[model samples]
Target: MIQQGISPRPEAQIFDADTHLGSNTFSIGPSRTSDGSTFLAVNSHQPWEGAVTWYEAHFHSEQGLDMTGGLFPGSPMILVGHNRNLRWSFTVNHPDLVDTYVLEINPDNPNQYLFNGEWLDLEVRQAPIKVKLLGNLSWTVKQEVLWSVYGPVVRQDHGTYAIRYAGMGLVDIWEQVYRLNKATNFKEWQSAMRQGGFASFNVGYADREGNIYYLYNADLPIRTEGYDWSLYLPGDTSETLWTQYLPFDDLPQVLNPAAGFTQNSNSSPFQTTLDPDNPHPDDYSPTLGIETQMSNRALRALELLGSDESITFEEFILYKYDMTYWADSDVPRMVQMILDAPTPQDADLLDGIEILRDWDYDADPESIGATIAILTLYDLARTSKSFLGSRLVGGEFTSEEVLDSYQRTVESMLEHFGRVDVPWGDINRLIRGNVDLGLGGGPDLLHAVGG
Candidate 1:
């Protein structure tokens, strides 16, 4: 069978280029904390203008809010924590769960499509979308919902596309949650995950007995080789259809790796463990569309913690709070470019450049250089959102752009604080009712907190 239409490089590696996916979240693996307590931490920083919320929540014998099963805040899953036995948390396990299929609509009858050398009629229905116009006035719009042999059909003027995603027709999320919360040991937890209810997530777990595990909770399709699953595929043939999900053991996971640590910074599962021990890409099928990209934090984690054979509790905490950008990160490269860029014969520009040049790269609260450097980096990120991913793929920042951002940062600092040498603690302040303190970390730091 000849494949008709696809991008030239259909098998090109899929990238999690969506910066918004992990903007406010970064999860790390289990490690023994300073208090000798095993901790699996996720930097759950949600921007808020109102009341402060916390993940370290406690629930007594209550219903809902005071209920037996309280929600995980803006989520349908129940809060799973200590119960005289164990504690657990989850990270998003992003695998290719959806595929787009292009079908040839029968020219003779638009309602029918060619599938497996046969014409099958599409199931069409109308979905009512009601909108409120004004006082007691509304409008009901009927939208067409079409179903093809592959899955849901999306009609366009040029062509039609069908979507096939994991957990397409399943509603067993609550059941999965219940089983997860009730699981006592690894055996029970494994059983619950094997049920494949929630579709995709990364499970980080540790128990009182020192058992640590990281599960790439995924129900991936067993796609056939030779077809690039990353691109839109031809739907006319049955060969493109996947029938079963990969078994649990086939998923990438690290159970008490020899390195004594496991982490996923929303990066590829191939980098979840220590060097040489992490899962190899060759072990899994490329058609699964697993990520090959690693986030900045993942690179940082490996750099800071990978070498330590046995980490003390203090070392663990220190590594977690690392604020220095990885050497090869875009921030460093861009900063270097800004420093090397020709100064515009301006006092503020010269002073700012000197400060950045003479200081350390750490986002220390008290560092005068850090204030301008961090602000300028934030400005750079906002202005050029294309620079969000790894430096290798996010396109290099030009010297002109870097100098422009440098000038802007200098001016903004002089305008807001009346001086360019303001301390990072002064700008990145944490304000409560009356108590305000200088915050040490900046965006994408291991301690990742931001507005």
Candidate 2:
């Protein structure tokens, strides 16, 4: 079926256009740190300027509320940050909390739909959308909105569809975040989380009490069995309607694991920590639609944080700024694919391949290799039909595509800089008013910077 307002495209080709929008948050417990002090890093990768851009702020009140962290424009409460006693941060989580159903509309009565062997009238209402025509001039249009037993109804060209999503009418998110900001300990924080107002996020929390926690927090709908929730479901049955959510206790979480650390880089909750501590896929129902993909940031986090036995605060800070891709990650694999392909006769293409071959997989500002590899990968991510996101999992690029991307990178570099060995910093720059600086870290790295 055609998605409303979106043009027809390959399902796999659908991706988040805001590639820079991701986050990395980790909590280190006392047992894993050198000084026996708990540490938490609250890092969110957001656009530098937008309505959702982060602004640092501290909120204080007489009713035992004190928080300092980042929040969106006009947001009264902090979305991710720390208080005096504890700290917590959020990273995006992928859970199937929404489902679309193909509704069987009655041709005899257009507003009536077939459900449970009975004809049900759709709830129709008028929604007013105000459009600004010019300065201080606005036009208000009343649009017809429909609702079904599932949720909102969308009339598509192919058929009528109803979408059901978690937290449909819940509007207490500010209250929950306020409770979280006022929480002074783990129990209080978890109690705040039990409000179940947040729809989806991977929460990384640490407190002065040496307690660390990682929660794959979501208001997940309890769906029926034997139906593929990923695809459109039959709307003509009550079985497809999910009216309840899983209890907050059933959500995947890790509390002060023996591993002493927990992280989420928009990856699978099953890989939040070491195997014994991480959530098991078998425990959750498949209808929940929890993702299983691991991002390169997640893999590198596991490598760096898992290997270090006792991490100092300095080391923790250093690890947070790491820019190297993992050895087994897709970047090196793609580089190898280019090398193993039939050698191109063009000298510029050959030079690009040699630069990639001799280069280390680090997105350092001064590194010439990163310039070639990252530019080519960015091009591939834009042009390749199979590419999805920074994770680069389940996507395939043929040798021809890889070579063509590399050749394009070489040509662009030659055209602009007169050489293929330009430093990454020269191109990937950070500019402000009268302040221009070179920045390190390419996309998907620990210190990710999207140029």
Candidate 3:
């Protein structure tokens, strides 16, 4: 896919990219490996350790108030501490670390499956999923589950294949987390990563020693040659079964980059760093596809974090709450495209366009102009992508349709609010901790999103 032209790349010298704060109470320690070395263990049952430690030690705030137990039942991660001795951060790593293959079944015997002229009984089990809606309203859905030598098998109309992912049955990852928590230097951290128990993530670390590093941390499988796992490959082929993983050193990474910063707002590696310090794209395989989407949040981060030199914590926090639209953002462009088009004959439509063109791009509750413009844009999106297909909408909105949507949306807002002059804050809200406060920034700003 083509990369979006939205520019901005956050290249801060981060101390830590990803680290799950270890919970002392609920965490399971590492087990002995075959070679006798212990595996990494970063996850813990207690998810509040990091947040509590940070709030109490640094901010002098109480711990239990901000803690939300582990977001996921089994997966736990956190980031805290400071200086050369400790720092870490993480990003989601979407690698094709898993695979599934359909096995050819015997037509004569349903219980027996043929593999390499040998027959084996399909392992069967039942999986029950719970569904809950209103109070005391709940139901269960049961599904037939299959298992093979490789792992679980997902049967569908097409066929059945075994499925596998990194660390499917073996290894507890928290062991590595424990090691990193105590690591005091690059070598110790390197040794932690070398353990290779982690399933997935992009990591960045910095220490009080002034050293910085970025790594794609995971146990990515080293599949046998000539298998297209991108789509389901023929499961009958034994070659599809991968027995090894690429070494941690073989993964893409950068250390102490001359550019002084590394940033990835979920975009491709091609643009992770400044021009002179960016990683070579050819280094990674196409099979391990990377993301290239540019989110408005990332774009805004790059705009400020990239160019700022003597940044302060106050400025940083303020930047996080910035809610202004950049001219290059996707939402603004859609609005602009409509505005620059030729005018239509409908009086209501022309009046709407006049209001939209006059908008200052602020979603502030008091800005009637902004309210009309955004309502019109929302209507356009609803008609173009949801209620009406592109064909039904005639490719894109005509100047007349733009006017109509503008008129209708404005009418609805007036009817609902009893006035068209409501403040932007009245519509865009950020609710948190008994606070339903009004906020700034529209749909495409740094603190992006209204309401």
Cα RMSD of all models vs. native, in order, equals 4.3, 3.0, 11.9
- Tens-place lDDT digits, model 3, residues 176-283: 755665566778877977877677766665555555666766677777645444555455545666777777777777666654445443334455545665566676
* Model 2 ranges off by over 4 Å: 1-20, 129-140
Error of 3 at 76 (Å): 7.5
Question: Which whole-number lDDT from 0 to 100 does residue 154 have in model 2?
Answer: 89
Highest lDDT among the candidates is held by which one? 2
For candidate 1, lDDT tens digit of each residue in 1-451? 3344442345544334453334212223344332445555444434444342433444433432221232445654454444444556565556898888888889889889898789999999999999999999999999999998679998886588888888889888778776766666778867878888878876666666666677777878889889867677888888888878988897888777766667766667888777676778999898787777766666787776667655666676777788777777666776788787766688878888888887677787888877877777767766764565322223456677677777788888888888888888888988879988898876666666564
| Number of backbone collisions per candidate | 6, 0, 36
Model 1 stretches with alpha carbons more than 4 Å out: 1-16, 20-37, 49-71, 74-80, 129-141, 309-315, 342-344, 389-395, 429-438
Q: Is candidate 2 or candidate 3 better by TM-score?
A: 2
Each model's lDDT comes to: 0.69, 0.86, 0.54
Which tens-of-lDDT digit does each residue in 25-128 have in candidate 2? 88899989998989898888988898988899988889887889999998879988889999999998878888877788999998999999999999999999
Best by TM-score: 2
